[model samples]
Target: MASPAPTSAPTTAERIRSACARSGGAMLAVEGLDPTTTPVHHLLDDGSFAITVPCDGSLVATVVSAGNAGVQAVLEMTDYAPLPLREPVRSLVWIQGRLRDVPIGEVPALLDLIASTEPNPALLQVNSGSSQGEGDTRLALMRLEIESVVVADATGAESVALSALLGARPDPFCGMESCWLQHMESAHRDVVDRLAARLPASLRRGRVRPLGLDRYGVQLRVEGADGDHDVRLPFAHPVDDVTGLSQAIRVLMGCPFLNGLRARGA
Candidate 1:
């Protein structure tokens, strides 16, 4: 398979914004609360939704509905706080953060905070604690985790490149299973096939698979064996942009682990 011709490169911000526009809109049928007390409505020119209720103190939860997807952000709107009292509602924060390029390690803490501040006292608890309860919250958390992994993996390629430049190497490990990893692996194979065709006959056996999805696009493992020694190439990316696939491969090949393998064959 010949590699596709290069096209213009879009910034990470542009790609994320495009994805959010495509998948961000959501409509939610909220239950377990008095419709009259905290009526949901859209605010902001961009269609960001919110629901506010009168409460003693500054404790408030803002529900953002975009299409069928929704995320609840909680805030303790008060004076003199270290971090912003505002926290994302369930997975909504996570999804929005990824689209906005928030860091990965910070996601779990945000999810946990939303989980703790639930079933607002002013509002009725509809499906709260039921088997199917916390549906929106749970879904949001999952989405956040997935998106976080994908974005982190995509953008972390630079770290891997830097490590290669600094003489870092990969230790052997088996692959983990997850939806994001699976998507990345598929993309890796596609890129590998295209690159293999362009390679000189001697390097034809190069293979690619995902090692993990971190705060980059995906960390990949590329392997080849020249009759004797085994060679492994490690790399990362922020997304599966085919036009940049060749550049990505070149970055991976620079890693010391892969460099060692290539030297073995040489």
Candidate 2:
């Protein structure tokens, strides 16, 4: 697919964390640190995530440099989501904020709180075979207080306010979007072709493929010599339920012409 232009959404952080929760792990960069990118396990809940890092690592060393070896530091978290098209990169989220560690005594309770929402197996490792303070000495639990979140997708890149991103929720079909898009491209090629017809004649000359589907619309990617261009066909109304979502897509199909014409034999 073509490179995404910058676009803003209030729900950007939720989408970012949702991508993180789904893909697992992100590229963590700490300023003036030896290791440019640290691979840490993060559990995102509420508006922040607790990242478990190596206690003796360069990242930890940097965090402690400010005399508060026991506290937090500023860092960056970048999350990437893969798309179906040739280019593959569908979304990119960059979150910059302060990262602080949780006291050893509170690790279990924090992990439990995270488990209540999404169970990340890595959090379990922190709970086993380690004693109070011992776990803290060997590992660092860092929390990121998001100062800003930037989301880049097909629509483009947009800076999202922390309040807006925190208050919003992910699309209802988020978890199923990937599989459903794959199914559409593989088994429902005819539907894709029909939908492509809805695009202006100028756009029909290029190769059209089902790009993605969300609560708001179906995205179609057109492959041209210049590059891939994405066009979104907005739904009549946003749908949180699968049934309503189906009806919306069917409406896009121009029901009376697509479905009815075929059922005329009945």
Candidate 3:
């Protein structure tokens, strides 16, 4: 078999963590409130999440009025394909938790902590606004105390325990996956063609595109005449860095030349 079934891949907990780390799109639906779409969210090291909302938003008002009790909420984080596809959503992580407003004085410290990992510009914006000399900050920071987690993908959906999720780390390549796959699609058509050759003949009947990348392997989307099918080509072994990733990809594409270079550490 050209594209042999992977002996192992990232576990559900790891995948969920990776999805949470790299995904920028999220929708928060609090009990008794409409779903709110926000891009300013971060998964904290402690398995909790922090988000910034408009200071005047209803969510902020609701949390404040509720006080220490907090509001029940479910956050849906979506991981979209780097490239355009018939089905763009690659995976989704549902984080169920209690939503509480973070005190203004503590917002800066939390933002600093989240920035160390993600460093999203929005965090900086919130941080600066909160520390301003005399004014109401436009951004209000809130924390989600995670109670449960569930992740869904092409494979299926699975519930992850809080402890398991906290122990797992995001894939090493997740942050770079979007750009790497985009580069692969534009500058490395020949490599993709070679990879397509490994697909089953039936899947080759339609368009093939690079769907996703991770430490474990590459996932290809085959847009068949009837529908779309996702296929995973696992690496011979899980990779931890770029060098290992390069060697794994070469082996998958059957590029003997590159394999030789990898073997020689060139």
Best by TM-score: 3
lDDT score, residue 245, model 2? 84
lDDT winner between candidates 2 and 3 = 3
Estimate TM-scores for all models: 0.22, 0.77, 0.88
Q: Please state the error at residue 263 of candidate 3 in Å.
A: 13
lDDT of 3 by residue, 180-221 (tens): 999999999988888889999999988999998888889899
Winner by lDDT: 3
User: Could you tell me the lDDT of residue 127 within candidate 3?
Assistant: 38
Candidate order by TM-score, decreasing, is 3, 2, 1
Show model 2 residue runs off by greater than 4 Å.
Answer: 1-21, 34-46, 54-56, 64-84, 127-140, 257-266
Clashes found in each candidate (C-alpha, N, C closer than 3 A): 26, 6, 0
> Per-residue CA lDDT of candidate 2, range 9-98, in tens?
225666665565455556666656553333344535466756776666677666645443333333344333234465666677777777
Model 1, 1-266: lDDT tens digits are: 99764333333333332222222233322234332222211121222323323331121122322323433322111111111212212112112211111123644454334335332321232122244444232122212112121122222421112122123211111112244345544555564454334445555654534443322233334445532111223234333443344345555444344323555656
Better of 1 and 3 by TM-score: 3
Model 3 is weakest, by summed lDDT over 10 consecutive residues, at: 127-136
